[model samples]
Target: MPRENLPEGFEFVASLPDPDGRVNMTDEIEDFYGKLDIDPVDPANISVGIYQWADPGLAYDAKITIIRLSDEEKADNAISNFKSQYDEMVARGLPIFSNATVNGHPSLQIKDVRGDNSIRYLFLWRAGSLVTLVEGNQDRNQSLELAEAAPL
Candidate 1:
């Protein structure tokens, strides 16, 4: 992820470590796919960037992960699968699933309530051969703002 394009008041924190030398998907990846009930597609490359708001009053953090597939076709397929799965979730009475256009790319905005009652916002979209997932501990609008500011 490019640091310069981050939203105003957001600062790059660190680059999270990738799963080490595994051909199969990691537990984290499996859990993410499990939530959507979709098979995980192994990415050719994965990049994770962590960011935090500079304002002391804001208690939100964003994690942006870009997964580059072997080709655009796979990227497209992955994004489509995510959209379909999210649609199913909405049909099952899940709250806060919507389609949006962020930075000119079609994105799915999801708000998930954890077991602890904490809220998480996710923005999923595809750009060329890259599939981006942005997760934040914030409101829907703030999550979209971060996704829009992201340099895909």
Candidate 2:
């Protein structure tokens, strides 16, 4: 299967940039896998990438992450695990989920209030063996839009 790449206008950012400066990108799989508490499948064959684009023109910073598992069952289980974990948070009013669809795949549109003024939007979906997430610093709708663009 082909790996998913970032959409137009987005570039890979090494880390959260300091004052909006470019940083060198590095191999991401090991780090990402290490951060995961649950082993969805063997981590070696997973394909993943993180991309960011700061748009002064649109006035929003966008980040998208694509993770492809080995098979459909693994991806489905991962999505279900994610939903269960986030559902607890939703119960606390920290983050909430809205039923959405991305490229014909069921999606969870997540919203969280950071403070009185700051809000975060995250959209996640599973299509076959691939799972995609789009997050924006400010734009709620943009996250869903990016999720729809994912190659399912």
Candidate 3:
């Protein structure tokens, strides 16, 4: 199905691809979904995705993860840490995006901290629980927005 056909919760995120070439949806998701591989030179190629239900509580725990490293070693370490941190957090039944790659692009996780947590929209890729985001944020809308903005 075309991207426009996808529902509001679904995100269309992908490009023509680069040196490695374009990636087919089913294959891409199926390929790295359970087992993500990391690339050094093109850290952009490593990313993570997250999908949350339309619930008030869920809005505060939806996010995506991207990793850009100079070498596979770094990516491996990141993957390891990400897994450990992700597992530790999700074990609590909190919403999260543990494994995903944004259109084969690389990115870091970032987080925000404040005194209050009420009436807040925080997509804690690793909120308060354990995994501290290294390059994402509390702006939970960005992920779905970016994905929604992508061209088919």
* Candidates' C-alpha lDDT: 0.68, 0.56, 0.37
Model 2 global lDDT (CA atoms, 0 to 1): 0.56
| Candidate 2: segments with Cα more than 4 A from true spot | 1-61, 84-87, 93-95, 115-117
Error of 2 at 137 (Å): 3.1
The better candidate by TM-score, 1 or 2, is 1
Off by over 4 Å in 1: 17-28, 31-44, 53-61, 80-91
Error of 3 at 76 (Å): 2.1
**Per-residue lDDT of 20 in model 2:** 42
- Backbone Cα, N, C clashes tallied per candidate: 0, 0, 14
Kindly list the per-residue Cα lDDT of model 2 for residues 9-70, writing each as its tens digit. Answer: 55655332233434322233332333234344443434333445564554444555556677
Q: Give the better candidate number (1 or 3) by lDDT.
A: 1
For candidate 3, the TM-score is 0.28
lDDT of 3: 0.37
What TM-score does candidate 2 get on C-alpha atoms? 0.58
Tens-digit per-residue lDDT, 1-152, candidate 3: 12444435543343323347454423422322334443322434434444443554544333333334445554454445444545644677655443433344332332233346432232222212122122222444554344333321
